[model samples]
Target: MNEYLTSLDRPIEAVRYAGLTVKLLSTGDGTEVIHHTLQEGSRWSMQPQEGWTASESIFITSGSLKVTVDEETKVLSTGDVVSASPIKQGLVFLALEETEFIYISSQPVFQFFSEIVRKNQELAIEVALKDGYTAEHCKRIMQMSMLIGERMELSPGDMCTLNYASYLHDVGKIMIPKSILLKEGPLSEEEWEEMKRHCTYGKELLEATDSPYMRASGTIVEQHHERFDGKGYPNGLQRDEISPLAYIVSVVDAFDAMTTDRPYRKAMSVENAIEELNENAGTMFHPEVVKIFIDLIPEWSKMKQGV
Candidate 1:
């Protein structure tokens, strides 16, 4: 590993295994993410070892591959996401169509999972915002969620989890087609159903990557769409049935959506968004989270006003 022209000037360069090239995205920042590209017919045979952990999450951006994790072997197609475990699992990247993926992890399956996961998260946030939400939305939700978590007196580590979880709350929306996403009218029932699938799809997409944060994030993503009144789709879980993270996200997500201009609706003034949230509290959102969210509205308003 050399530091010249490497991504971010990190002290590590590329880890090569057969026809796959794994580039370290960062190191020690705890946001481990990686960019992995595999050539056709590449195979990584794992030799059972100790003291190191590596989990391979393959997001087939293009082409196909046959990945065998332990005793299970699965064929991954473009857009398919899968993960390798800490246990001895050999992977054969047979590119059925010349595959590419942004591989992410907390500890490199071989040498750098931490950097991979962190960098991948940063990139994932960028990819997710490709829908036009902007990375600023993630920053706001992260700040707001941490503030809410503090009010509830959550543990530091738990609050950190909430921070990243909040940043990724809308990650599932990445899979939504941009046409429907940017449509200037109320979503058709079919479009609505497609949107609803993001909750489940996002979780399924991350289930294999083996990042604990991503694992925990799966639940939040799955339930962020739920309503306080059990009216949300995919799962109509209501009130306390939803996780606390989801409760926090519901408030933040709604607030952002209303406050930000979308193709279908003009942006409501912050005051109006807050008033709507307040009016619908305990019906559309958790009342407790609403209080905290409402309090932050002032700061958010100032930020939006560029004050």
Candidate 2:
């Protein structure tokens, strides 16, 4: 019997290039499923490569597209499907409008996608070494963020975004001077301003990478510091203007910060942290996220004690 798999169960390998968004849905056993979305007027060309011998079946799931195989051109609409054999000349695709389609092929063309994942992991390690405190903090934030996401029943895609955002949220600190980042005392106004630039810096760094994980989580990095009452850094976006993933990270980040020792102060007790979360709920953090986090901590503590 054959197995069934949803898109969520498979890792999404996506590339955004030349007005096209190509996602490799699955790559296994010499077969690959690709989802492609092309913007209007965008053209994509594929030339035959030496030693590449795989046929492709293209299905137009939405909008319209123009496909040219060799010298043959065909316009296809929704529900239309076409197949191209392995030829020496290859093919080209043009989106008549905003179009979406699935391309199933028998070749392994997704090695670049795996490379992106590997690069992200290496960057995370570099960031972690730059600040040991942030390294531990990120781990706790990741755990707490995932727990809250599960309680809220976020979709797999959302959870994936949240996970990456939580881990890399402070990656911008790498750009900050060690003097400001590891200062033993409170920052001067100028130093504080420089410190706050981490949010924007993080977003800019991630956006510049153009990696799929970075693209998905860049906004979260930018807006995680924003408060519900509209008084935060980088941007003053408030309330619903912030992404839900940002709100989730904000709550967990704050909780972990409070419960961990800092250069200037001792770690607050869990009870004290809970009180602070409650008091600042709906102002500094999302009220609902704060509530869920506060409720979840006791369970987390019990587990830590192996009770």
**TM-score of every model?**
0.60, 0.58
For candidate 1, write residues 1-307 as lDDT tens digits: 2334544644556654324567766555343566667665433222222443655465667777774444466787879976656534323344555567766654644342334334435544554433345556665666667667767865444554565467666666667777775566578998888978878876765554644445556777788878889998678999889887788877887788777765445778877887899899888888988987777677666655645
For model 1, the local distance difference test gives 0.63
Scored by lDDT, model 2 comes in at: 0.71
- Residue pair clashes in candidate 2: none
Clashes in each model (backbone N, CA, C under 3 Å)?
20, 0
lDDT of residue 42 for candidate 2: 53
lDDT of each: 0.63, 0.71
Q: Over 4 Å off in model 2, which ranges?
A: 1-132, 302-307
Model 2 / residue 110 / CA error / Å:
12
